[model samples]
Target: MGFESVSDFLAMGGHGLYVWLSYAIALVVVVLNLIAPLRTKKQIHKEQARRLRREQSQI
Candidate 1:
């Protein structure tokens, strides 16, 4: 873990492409895991609001 520079650190013992790609894919999956739940929550809230409004209108 004692690389002289940023380039050397990222080079990862000449496996840079595979290492960086794995990191990128991991990041994407984590971000999607976070985002998907929030999106579903928003959809649920919208549906609940619509249902409430319909019930109010019926009364």
Candidate 2:
């Protein structure tokens, strides 16, 4: 099962839409999984900094 050209390979025997879409969705999910934790960590750092500043200002 060999494709003679790039187009044929992408077509994937006329199931290209499902195949490519699934790949794209999987990629997005993987990227989000990576990013979500970093974003959450940043948010937590920001909140902690704000709380520390407030406590220092009170003193």
Best-fitting candidate, measured by lDDT? 2
Backbone-clash count (model 1):
0
Candidate 2 regions exceeding 4 Å error are none
The alpha-carbon deviation from the true structure for residue 51 of candidate 1, after best TM-score superposition, in angstroms, is: 0.9
Tens-place lDDT digits, model 2, residues 1-59: 99989999999999999999999999999999999999999999999999999999999
**Predicted model with the maximum TM-score:** 2
Error of 2 at 37 (Å): 0.6
lDDT of 1 by residue, 24-57 (tens): 9999999999999999999999999999999999
Q: Give the runs in model 1 whose Cα sits over 4 Å from its true position.
A: none
lDDT, residue 28, candidate 2: 100
Estimated TM-score for each candidate:
0.84, 0.95
